[model samples]
Target: MIRFFTTIGGFLLGSLLITLLLIFALNPSFLAKQVLSYGAKSFGVPSTNKVDKFLDQTIIDGAIDSPLALTYLGLDSLNFLTGHKSKLGDYSLEKSESDYEENLKQLNYLSRFNQNDMPEGNYNLQIKRFSLDNDIRGYESFRYHSSPVTQFFGAHLSLVEFLTDQHKVNNERDIQFYFDRINEVPRVIDEIIGFLDKRAESGIYSPEFVYIKAMGQIDTLSTGRIEEHPLYETLEKKIDEINLSKNKRENYLGDTKDLIREVFIPAYRRLFNTLESQSKNAREMVGVWGLPNGNDYYKHRLRIYTTTDYSADEIHNIGLKMVSEIQNEIRSILESEGYDISRPLPELYEVLNSEERFYYEDSDEGREQILADYTKIQNEAMKKMPDYFNELPKSEVIVKRVPVYSEQSAAGGYYQSPALDGSRPGVFYANLYDIRATKKFGMPALSFHEAIPGHHFQNALNIENSTQTLWKKFGYGTSAYGEGWALYAERLAIEIGLVEDPYELIGSLQSELFRAVRLVIDTGMHSKEWTRERAIDYMIKNVGSEESEAISEVERYIVWPGQACAYMIGRIKIMELREKARNELGDDFDIKDFHSAVLMNGSLPLTVLESVIEDYIAESKT
Candidate 1:
């Protein structure tokens, strides 16, 4: 009887093992999850213990399904494990719809787990819920005139930039992956063209001006020779660093050139032709106000970007009020400096802008100096962190210039977070495309906003925090939460004595003023049907921005509705919360604690943020 029992146990165990092997073979994602779990455990992240398993599995599946998201997260192994050896994911509309449904499915599965049962569940739940809700809403509701290509910052521009900057090329395998992506560019372009054609068929189109810019951008890409192309040149630069033989190097270069010329350039030329022909049907009107159900669309945008229920008129009024107060403060500062306050602000800006001392030389040396000064500003802000921040990011933030190709359309400066593995530091890309246009006074505040105690602090902390799940760390937060904190950091620098010079102080105020003007102009164009010129004029008259700068900003607003409004709206809420905390806690209020409370839970909606602050206040009172 004992021998018979032993034989049965052995048979059952072998059968179970074989079944699991078959499952792993059939479902690669299951095997991928097991591999990811081991990797996560090596990094001290728990995957099998509790609710975190849900998060780890979600991130694994998400990265496998989306190549761009995968690249941004610095995860490459899963792409190969999932049989996507050399290509990004499909960009077709059918793929997009299927992905949307999959997200909804995951969301449903996630909702079944009770968030209250876990230690850090609320933060994870809120971030995931907010992300999924917004994506679903945008995908389902906002498809009328939405095309895949945008002259300013869509897949067309961002993909090439991503390949150059974010995609790693460390070894022969990585190089082959790079080649595969480049070779796939034509198919991607064709997919986008299909979407554009669908929009055209639906009587929806990008504005005529968008077509003009898109064609110009495409022309810039097409007219350039393959040898001088950004794609080709970046690969040439990367290949020289690899220790490959001469024959291999030549072959790699040849492959890259063929991909750029035969595959990439022709695809762009095709896009250019498509846009040129489509422009004949495109309207002159720029805003969504002219599109089908435009009002509802604009309202959805306001709610989505600001994460608030505020109306267009109310936001407009808030912008107007803030502008008046900020301008008055500027006037008082100028009066104390013995400048004539009688002249209009724009004329004053013209005079101050002409001063040689206020700007660097329009040369390479001057651009390097701007970067150096920004570093200094970042260092100075770091010195003041102990006073207001209880926790700071472990990662460093480096300053860099925006890529030359996209600099014309890129904003002044933006922050990219460090890799999760700590291989790369966070980068702040300042637009030094036109060195003369870069302002010395503006550099200080920009540094503070984009680097230390701003985006770098908020994002890196969120990414590094072990308490939150993997999804919360990797998931993209709302524009309002991220942008609002950065803007508030600009003001905090002034409070902490970083902006001591009058000019630097003015630069900070001007930054605030710029966001305020965005509130007015963004709403003005999208909701009130203000002409593009009228919006640009409003920015110039109020904020004293240059014509080219105003035009770029207005065009950006035209393409990205309600995004510009988030900064001021978010800043105002953060300020209000701080004041309420201070008022309630009085002498007991700790700035560092207040900041940690705001940041400890990662980004949250304004409504959720208010409740968190109130909870902090109550806990402090006890």
Candidate 2:
């Protein structure tokens, strides 16, 4: 879940000029205007060449400097902006340091623009300004020892997932780019190892448990046969689909196998060895509190993740209170569902977990059925979106399984936004690693959160809304805003009658309860020094999550620090603002309009979102 840090470096004088232009001026709004102008080059709204050229300069510069960003955005058609030379990113420490300097230059330039010059109520500028400010703040902190590679999502697996889920191999050029990337894998590994070594020198080491999990991930990638490797297998499958001649296909396949065997496998072996060496000295300590200046580092993490000033004690108390209330609600639901609740809640959960109907068979058919059911839930939820939202996204979202290699450490489910041009559909990857973990009752809330009215809705709307610049759509977002909306979407589904089944309603509450539990356990571990086992035990006891699921969740928080706190914290803040708006606007308040105000500007920090809601309330009163 770590956002890849961006950096700037020294280049030749001519390249520096272009890099400065790219850094100081790039914005998505500018690109939208260009696309609009190009579509109506002749007659419709006349273009202002002077204004257009200025914006185009930013787009061109960004496209050149950050080819990977364009690739991630699925912008192959715009390759001419970068001369169609496809390339991956430079992950070395040297490049990172240079990029940091470049970010400072960009920030310096952005500071010159006065908000007054922009259109009235343009929070987009506010978003960009805040984003640059945050970037600078993080860079200055220099807490590079923070876990960069974890079992969750480090370079080790991201490369594999990127190629399988993202990198398109449509034809010869695309395939060639794929091959070029294969050779770059070793360089990325070495860069990561170098960073890790630097961190170890600073007495920074991930917990022993993390090394154990990550080592398993590395083994999964490096243990298989050359031809059977996921990197080789997935790419080979894609190449077969291409209309290449048999000879060309064989050449590509042979080249890929050789690269995997000679370079990729050996690189992974090196990584495995490095991690194993590091693990010998790894401590059993779980929280950031155990690291050097760890207390201060955790405080910084809280600011970034929750975008709030809530203290660890305050968050811990909030989680405790929310957990109690949710448990009561769940008890009432169970009583209504004909379960005797006189027994302790944990005992009652055993009955719920034992229900075979609530899970699928443990086989390939079960995995396929899970994906199909998620799609069905998304469709059903889409039918109710108009009642609660006036601005639904046009882009489609598909459901897929998390790749086997990463699912062992991945979250239950997550969403990826669609490409800017809509060539690639948004994807919701559900972790079906174990059938028992994918409970049937939780399907609706899970689907709604990761697919429609959740990520798919919030993210696609951001991308589709050309008025909100690329910064707001892509760059300027927080877990609080993005995840908060998704969690809130779960509640919206219930209020709008999308979740009518009593079991489904219970499922939604359980999902929410899990988030609430995070607030407590995350704070207790990081701030209060709760053991990892204690945190896991609390989740299993309270949220009724499987033992293995709870373990994975705890390890995730250990690596991520304060991120688990964001979901509940953000959700609570948004819900509070909604209530305030409803009370102030009274009969004039429209749920649909309130939602539009929150969503249409794309995601924002809780504080900024509160301001936006206040503005909406005042506008409604008048």
Candidate 3:
């Protein structure tokens, strides 16, 4: 009887072990393959064992939440919720550090990986990954923790601000999300305050002016009667828009009102208290140059933004040279129009501004007309694209006004990312806040920069790339490459004869000159101890932008540091590489093929881009 029972137990144990082995053998490799397949699906590329190994290592390295990676994966919303909450001046240093460490590990892994054994396409993807990791790590070492500029700026005009402005009031779920976010604001504010406090202790506080400007925005956002609060308006409107049962709707409305009464007002009050406290202690200096190791911080910013080791002095010198060259070109154009060459550049800008032919008045009709004209311009430009680009974006493009409330602080124009599913069109937001700023003369080049063959082209192509991972499709595109491509696109328009009018040509040159000035002024304020006034003044003298515009641009450079330098530096590298290809391939070189080579990979660091182009040149030659 004892032997019979022992035999039965042994049989059961052996069967269980065999089952476990089968599960391990069948599922483990399949799980690994699924993970690789998911990455491949995200990038619209095919799966391979090499990609599987890379994906496995990515999971092991734990950089799934890196900002660039998250952006690339169409998981920006998730990343924002987890890593960045929507609150004025709120940022989390602890999270940033964690992200940094993970990114560094991933980068190190990529660096050590055997790239020689990988396919060139896979290696290209790896290079982009490394570039993104390097950029994030560079920012981590700099003044990234010093202030929350995006939040501070967004507090003035962001999606939330837009919702508020639209008076979105009716949906119960909408109200709840509103109140939920509102209740969360104070906690977010506390986190931000904690970050600022640490920076202050380390002598890394923002200029007093920034806090003053921020406080004004806060007051503007929160000053209305409680019922009239922007937050309340947004809750009310959004709630009304959603279809729900009457009973559920009423209950949600009541709960939302109660939450607003009990939670939101107090959250704003807490945020106000924090900002008011910081305002008192804020320093007067307007630039990061005041901080310890500030110069080094600025230099690091330049390197990261430009993806180059060019010094502030080198950029500054380049700006001076370009200013003279652009001026000469402008003079030649003005002379062709019978204007005196001896006249100042500012005078040319003045003439351009005052001419009735150059502007539409600030009326709704005028705005519509401008939009129509921009559309017309884009249509005309699209007809000429085969002259340059071999490939085009699958996504459609539209021109729209920057929403009224946010237009004040928004740039002249910006491209909204296309939907991952391609349900929505890529939008080029033209800031018509000050119609004069959107002068008619600037439309052609501006259209080229923001719409057709500019951001819309490059960014949409990235999203539509079927040969890359969702991460590669969305992730590793750098600002230098992206913005540089747009800036270069502006030049491409000139090359394609899109800018027919000399004034339009001047506008193109002016835009290029603006980027050149940024290279100088960004480096100057951050690395050379140039004051805000000096940077602004230099811009006015050289770039011919309005004083107000110049000041805003200068202030942006102060907070953003190296980002401004990406445009020209990136454009120069691309143009240089194209010229190299043009020279090497000579009769064999196809302009369309050259463009395809540059843009087909989406955005890459200048160094990686050079390699891709070199390969293209070699392949084309053969």
State every prediction's TM-score relative to the real structure.
0.93, 0.89, 0.83
Best by lDDT: 1
Superpose all Cα atoms of candidate 3 onto the true structure and report the RMSD in Å to 1 decimal: 6.0
Every candidate's CA RMSD:
3.2, 8.0, 6.0
User: Ten-residue segment with the worst summed lDDT in candidate 2?
Assistant: 40-49
lDDT of 2 by residue, 119-234 (tens): 55555556656665666666666446476679887888887777666788888888878877777788889999999998888778888878888889999888877777888888
lDDT string, candidate 3, 1-622, tens digits? 3343378778787778877678657654344334434654555664455543565445323333332333333432342233312222224777667666766766665665576657765555455465655557565665433576332363334434433532223334335444545666556556656666776676566676676666655565555565565565556556667777788767766776666567655655565666667677766665566766666776776766777788888987887787788788888998999887687877766766678877787799999999899889999999988777767887888888876544555678877767665655788878787777776778888889888899988888777778654444544557788889999999989987888888889889889988988878887777677888998888888777767677667877766778998998899899999999989988998989888887777578788788889999989977
Tens digit per residue, CA lDDT, model 1, 1-622: 4343378778788778878889777887777767766665533345444556776677766776777766776667677466454666577889889878987996897787665765532556655676688778778877755667676776678768878887787888888889888888888889888888888888888888888887887777777778888888888888889878999999999998888888888898998999999999887778889998888889888888899989999998899999999998988888888889999988888877778887888888988888888888888788889878888888899998887777776688899998877777999999887665677887888888899888999888887787655654555467788899999999999998888999889888989999999998888888888999899899888887767777878988998998999999999999999999999999999999889887877678787788789989998999
Arranged by lDDT with the best first, the candidates are 1, 2, 3
Taken over the whole model, the C-alpha lDDT of each candidate is 0.81, 0.80, 0.69
- Pick by TM-score: which candidate is best? 1
Q: What is the TM-score (0 to 1) of candidate 1?
A: 0.93
Over 4 Å off, model 2: 1-63, 80-86, 110-119, 124-126
Candidate 1 vs 3: which has more lDDT: 1
